[model samples]
Target: MKMTPPVTGTLELAHLLTRRGWLRTTEFNTPDCTVWDYAPSLPDQLAPEQKGAPTAIFLDNTGESEFYFVEPATRTTQWNPYSRNFDRLEDLIQWLPVIENWRAPRSHEHESPMGFARLRAQGLITTSEMMETLEHFPYVPVDPDAKVPSLSRTVAEIHQAHNDKLLSKNEFKLLTHNTFST
Candidate 1:
């Protein structure tokens, strides 16, 4: 599959899975979904054969015999290594909300992206950390799953979203306000 260029890698993978119409109906109907980020979390109902593994930022069906997973970076069919190395989504695609046609419609929401600001507000990602990260990388997406030189056990594992870059000087002021005494 030819992936979109502007928003390739992780963002594409994220958008494809969460977009309005891409999930398989029955699976979507299951209503037990979680965007896995290495933490072992699940919905109220659990599938007989489901457990949290060391997933970075993929979404998984918490109730499938095959330990079903959706890779957040590649959006490929993945199953538990113990159960099966590979699985095909051809069958599941039928019930999907819509065909996998990549199109990032221009929307207002796209204007301002959601990222580390929340983490910074919560004191998870500090201004110094963001500044430090900026020094190394001119612009960095707020994806915790992203591989970083320095990281703590933060909630968002901003996976290295190569396509989406955030360059904001104003952000530093907001995040660093409390760092300095008024």
Candidate 2:
């Protein structure tokens, strides 16, 4: 369950899971979001009830993501309640096995990225359902090759100094040329 710090980006998260022995089974993309389905490499790794079930990670363009367990037969989905708003990567790593074994209640039929695509293709989903689906797995317009912006080393030092109270507000403003502010 040990892992490095939690990544805020999709690609990093995917790499983390793959390194932990989860096999990427399928990847689906749309203008709004990208969904990757993963399953344990060994069947024995799954919970008895979750054997053969797949888990999904939905990554949105804004670097937000959600995890869900999908039931293969009914296509029912369950969101991992423990997976959100975590402050540490270890928290998520500890929950990975639990999430993989989690199952949605048969009585509740929640929307999943995979289920949405399938139902949408068959024309079985309504506009409202589609909207609801998107709410859970929103559009992720990520460009894999796009370079993320980073502050210059000098700027970073100034920012750090400001944070550490080594620089007064006026001093920070003067040192950064008013280009950035916390």
Candidate 3:
């Protein structure tokens, strides 16, 4: 499937899956992409056979990606058009709430684009990280039965997500203050 250039890789996959009726329609974001690795994750829920499939782990400084879609009956990890490899699916899934809280549309909340931009303009997210996410999309593959990461783990891995740069300084400040506020 042709992916959307402006949208994150996870959104591209989520859009495809949602369009195909594989998952319920919901906002997609970096954190959401991260948390999709649980045994009860959308993929496993959609296709129970995929549980326990072998997973490919991809890692870097910023974050990681993973790939583990396989037909349980076949017992082979299949790389669909949208598969990524991460050190652990669990770490990715853990970030879902954060991303969602930060980016999802809400009746009373402003979108993160504005906030992210503000933060970028203020030099909070860092120009280097922004450039990286833009060049290489970060996504994770979910396998229900894959080994979970340890409690000592942080973000299974790290990758660049420059898309955050799209937001203006005001927008980013609003996003961070609103989403991350105590």
TM-score of each: 0.18, 0.31, 0.21
Model 1, 39: alpha-carbon shift in Å?
13
Pairwise TM-score winner, candidates 1 and 2: 2
Candidate 1 lDDT (Cα, 0 to 1): 0.29
TM-score order, best first, reads 2, 3, 1
Q: In model 1, which range of ten residues has the least summed lDDT? A: 102-111
Best of the candidates, lDDT: 2
Residue 25 lDDT in candidate 2 = 45
Report every candidate's CA lDDT: 0.29, 0.41, 0.31
Over 1-182, each residue of candidate 2 has an lDDT whose tens digit, in order, gives: 33333335546767877776555544464434445554431223334455243455544343344433222222233543223333344444554553444333222344433444345446677534433332222111132121221354323544665576544577556544523222
The segments of candidate 2 whose C-alpha lies over 4 angstroms from its true place after superposition are 1-7, 25-27, 40-53, 62-94, 103-182
Better of 2 and 3 by lDDT: 2
Q: Show the colliding residue pairs in model 1.
A: 143-158, 144-157, 144-158, 145-157, 145-158, 145-159, 146-158, 146-159, 146-160
| Residues 105-164 of candidate 3: C-alpha lDDT, one tens digit per residue | 111112122333344457776655443222222122345233322211111221111244
Tens-place lDDT digits, model 1, residues 17-125: 5563333333232333334232211223334554422223223434333223432211122432211111333332331221122111111111112244334445666
